[model samples]
Target: MLTDVLKPEKTTRKNAKPIWLMRAGAASELETSVQDWVDASAFKAGAGTVLVVPDRKPGGIAGAVLGLGDGDDPFVSGALASKLPAGDWFFDSPSTADIRLASLGFLMGAYRFARYRKFPEERPSLILDGSLDRSELVALAEAVWLARDLVNTPANDLGPDGIEAAARLVAKDRKMSVRVVKGGELQKKNFPLIHAVGQASQSAPRLIDMRWGRRGAPRLTLVGKGVSFDSGGLDIKPASGMRNMKKDMGGAANILALARLVIDARLDVRLRVLIPAVENAISGSAFRPGDIYRSRKGLTVEIGNTDAEGRLVLADAIALADEEKPDMILDMATLTGAARVALGPDVPPFFTTDDAFADSLSAASLIEHDPVWRLPLWAPYLRGLSSGVADLCNVTTDGFAGSVTAALFLQQFVTGAKSWAHFDIFAWNPVAKPHAPVGGEAHAIRAIFAALRQRYGVTRN
Candidate 1:
């Protein structure tokens, strides 16, 4: 049903054109291949190289060879998207049957968040010849694009209330139930951490909850940090640090997008999405770094830094999710710079105490081409969050291991869930790459969705 929007043409198949995806390496190993075809034709055969070779046989049009980056790093194969000429193309090989990566690259290449401006014409499509479900691929692409668009929008258009409205719209469209605790209601609800971080913003802080699916199905709870704009509260970020803060709610966008996919696919699981939307703005009433606040989990947290507000809101959300003792609890946040240091913008780092859940995620990530690496919820880092006056600190004073400590800080409130995982995502692309132009990005969303599918055994119609 979702695939109706992306009706395929007969030409959108691998056999439509013969294309070879080539990898480059040392000259010794890089003899005549697709790379040679690119070089011979005078086309730059660097990473993301797309070369069209004319058929030597009379009247036959030459097939194509997509140049992956230097063979040393295969992941950059996605770079080939930039090199291909504007036309439809597909992978030539049948042995590499898992076409999800190619599909992912295709969508990633097509992404351009040009809300303020117009997007350039998209390059021709690279069709996969394999038997993988075309409809699923289209749905996945649409979901990722949806997440990116929501992230790329300015805070003026996607503030806390706007984000809640979007969630409600999605819920209404899907015939799901939705609830929101806003303004004074958040205080009544005892979401003090959520209130403390967002009270200064005029838009008002709110907790968005959306639920769908049949009763008795395994519960899958997703919590996302929704810091719509991080002005860094009273602590304040330097001008450079705050420039792109509007993209701070990327985690919220990602969860909502993933939620849409699950509902669209009619997955056989009870799903709940929680987004604590807020703006970490500065005002006389803004929460301060030294302030102590009570969390929904009943834990007292000392504000180690106002800039670390993402984790604070996420803590309250995760705690509320844990109250349900869901089968799985996964929380996403653009919560730390330390994670970016450990792994670049492309690779999101996740931490979990459950070994089985981690392995499932690892396998799903590889299969989906939306990979995430696991970091330890190493208990030793717990000491970093100790507070002199409160039960814990929202952030560690020591600059080292900030990501790990942030994960650990959130973990303190997750007692009821059977399994819990935290994803520290960058949710942004500083520069353009093929279809994914510079703007907000949705990292690790696909992988987690794949894992959920495996966990619930999604049945196709």
Candidate 2:
């Protein structure tokens, strides 16, 4: 259950009602009454105008209006959650409006990473009118919350085992079945790359598998990189580079969050989630930079740089996902610094060979307001990953197109999926935004969810 904030002094309609409104370009006929009230009333707040208005219509009660001073900023619609009075309120408008994205955004925007500290005050609540499906909205919010919570938890408590445990807990909560292949089990499962990277850690390495939805539905496979903490293994990172390595597994957190949404929405698809959980820690037994390992896909990879271990683990997980020959495969990872360099921290870069799939995802981002940009899976970049003695190298020899090369490496492992998409997300908001506090964030999950919903339609709980 989510927390709500409501003041006793605030005026309410017939039922202690709460709703969110958008102030657009010039007041329309629909908003004429509200606009007149705002012009007449004097409020102290500047940007986010939260006030209860009188609604004397037949079944209507008091309504809440959120101020978007300038109509130019599109992100303002979702940022209203931070300013409104705290309470579990629903939207006052009809559900026919395409505002599910804003509903999810409101929940995500109001989110604060509070494990390290307490919030100064309660956040506002949101309620949607009878139009949109409540369960789908809640599922989307919960999934994003899970991603933020797992990524925000300090590395000390969220190591490899802890990550696996979190996935299991979510599986149990959703009444889904899960299987964990850990430590020696990796050898049995034939996921050598996943085991090699995690063997050096005391926490042990694990591959988390979760299944949900009807058995006969279309299969949709999701793989996430779960390097809980990256000390850069034997290669070692500079102090600055290592500072936020705890968020290295942010890819895994985001995927699990998306998985939660899929199950909660009950989408008409057979969902499979694979998270290769590991910690790239330094130790005497840690896999060395020159080591060569066989992947589950049967391709041999030479470790050019230990820091490029996220793809290695994901390679095995993707191979496993491919074996199912799913309709689509989506893998998320905080895999490359180059992606951040190209798009900065907020917009993640995704790669896919299927044109229709790419368009669907791109359009869904615009509709959902959880934007992700597309980067080509340039076939020419395949040469950058060539190895003298192995099928490929984990990194590029000249250090160019790091994100592209990383995507190319993972592509080698995907064989049977009809369509595949890879996301290189920063997954952390360095600075605070209205809905997102400065901490681990779920960058592309919402966009992907929107695409899924469009493809398969929403499934209610």
Candidate 3:
């Protein structure tokens, strides 16, 4: 639980510390004494900078002033989780800041992937003064932490089997039903593309299908490309490119995280999470680059590059999800390095034909502070994936608009869903930030959740 770092204020402590959060312009408006102290100490109110004030009574500590810079950064308070002194603390003036966002920032900032650590690190705690919904904040933080944990775990401990275990854990908590289609079962179940990708690995590839919520509720299907570890199969990736292949399954981790949020909130929607879990390992049995395989959707896909296995697995899962003709279908994948090259690691690029949906996602991205940029499913790029031997090639040969081509390839498998959106995400944060540490980060899930809430007219408490 996030209670270790974020807790509701039940009773006041006699010596509770105060944290005075301030923007640069507001510093001058502080009480005369406080302003004088800040000026004398050369505190410029730069973002994330802190200055501890001494109490009037000797040997006691007064409130602390934290810089908010221009007050534009929603996650400015995140830095305080690591910077503040130990003990209970609360916002000096609750109305001066968005308490919910601040608390979330602090909780996320306090997160550490200490599962395998010999010595755990201590994190500063914040006392919520009932200004925010405790359950909602905790649920969101836990969901994000869950994604980080799944992505940070090595492939040795988190392969196709491990991915299934994680989904089962979430299902067990929610009393949801889970079905696994594995090994020869995948072939019999018509998940040929998914099975083909994992045929080389000793661990059987499987489709983890989890369902929750009332049967008659509106259907929302989520598909994630769960390439447990992408060794690029027979094509193989360069050693440098394969260093962090464990995170190739980041898409599955994220969907599971999003599912947790939806289930914990008990959203008024029937949710189906489809994860095509596999490892694109190389061996004599590995699917070859020249091979053509029939997909679950019945499209014969020519293998343009065996390394482009994420879209193949996702194609099968997306087809399965679309078969139900859900109200909406959303799929996420760390499928293309081209996406990372186009948007960098921080901004994930989304693809959808629905203009209004794109606009809503854009609005949610800004409001949720979980940024995502929309990239076109350019029809012109469809020719790039043309194959003479089959319905289409798995990838483009020219290497232009690689991300767009990948999205277009997946689009071919979806014929039932009313609306579809594909998120090509670099789920790993490459650098440390105020609210995000340099490890597996949950990209775009929060924004998508916010959009879902608005669409369903569900309000957070």
Candidate 4:
């Protein structure tokens, strides 16, 4: 989609339509002809609204006016890409908005998941102005598109093996080293929790490990929960709850996208990505709700509910990541519905003990327009996960603080990392927005990337 729309040329086309961006109060200051058109069309410069001006010349469109609302959001420029008629378009004038952000928004807005479509519609093209970094914009858009594509694919086509294949593609593209531990190898390698969760499915559970960058650099480890299709195991979800189960692997998709951005930017950090890919399907071999399993961290976990399998896989992955004592360990998962209940799908809730890290992430979230709200890692909630038969229970019986308890569960596996944070994200967008469509969405990754760039002193140049 990006390749079709974003051009490398800096020069505007002879016949390309001029897209004039306007804010609400500033419409009165426009050129007489444009102002007349705005008045005639009753264009108020409301966000996501577009006004087309017919051409005086004998060809395509003459120009267009895009609403900027109060001129606060730069990403509103994305609306023009989707709303405009099919033709070449260029920014008519410059403003205070970041050119890079606007360009990225345009590319992202133009994205379409046409892999299964028999007839995909043609998208409008934009002539690049050379003010933004084209390479970086393309890379970011492509990474985001990849994440969306992975999440949008159904479980029937994308299971544990499919996830491994996707990881290998990323590793191959970046020249990184990748290793897969699968089947009996997982049990031998002490990933019992991962094995138990995925044992019911014919598609074997596996661990995907990818490493890159210089060994001596500050280690940054990422762990993602990859449950391709969650049937809730023996404790199955109702029909409505199971409808979008294909998107359960959203966390894995997001981490891989972030890794791509980090590698593409060549950040001065040794990157390690661990994904515990599985399917919580019910079968004769399905792990029962009352079963007790030993985790990679040496903690005994009693299965209070098979529906809480995401944390189980993450525990083993986080334990392995902690062994290296990375400078920072960041884990993302679509682990709990309680997070969505508290904050809704648009805002992901994050948990971290480090104050400075939280502050940085919060600031980055604002700057990147990727919303994330901080939730307390309240130590008191540890009591909720206590088990009578084992060291801990996979889920709290009361179901009071589901998101908090899940974070607490994963936190037990990490003692070595200097700093650690967890993101409970709903990867799917329940409804469409101007810049993001309703489908598999990449949450918090941009904010994390921005934070990493600032922390590591990396530049967009």
Each prediction's TM-score against the native? 0.88, 0.87, 0.95, 0.96
- Which candidate ranks first by lDDT, i.e. highest? 4
Q: Please write out the lDDT profile of model 2 over residues 433-452, one tens digit for every residue.
A: 66678888888887898788
lDDT of 1 by residue, 1-461 (tens): 22322226455453345556555552422336645656677664456666667666784445666556563333343554555555666666544542455555655665655667774465655564546676677767878888888888889999999899878877886878988999889999889999999999999999998898887788989898899999999889999999999889989989888898888888888889999999998888899878998888889999888999998999889999999999889888999999999998989999997898899999988766676999888889899899899999877777889889989898899998999999999989887665467888878877888888777876433
Error of 2 at 453 (Å): 2.6
* Total clashing pairs for each candidate: 8, 11, 0, 0
- By TM-score, rank the candidates, best first: 4, 3, 1, 2
Off by over 4 Å in 4: 9-12, 27-29, 58-60, 96-98, 458-461
Clashing pairs in 4: none
Give the poorly placed runs of model 3, Cα more than 4 Å off.
8-14, 25-27, 57-59, 94-97, 118-121, 458-461
lDDT of each: 0.79, 0.81, 0.86, 0.88
Q: Worst lDDT window (10 residues) for model 2? A: 4-13
Q: How close is candidate 1 to the true structure, as a TM-score?
A: 0.88
- Using lDDT as the yardstick, the better of models 2 and 3 is 3
Which pairs clash inside model 1? 24-71, 48-79, 48-80, 55-62, 89-127, 109-435, 110-435, 111-435
* Candidate 3: residue 111 lDDT (0-100): 78
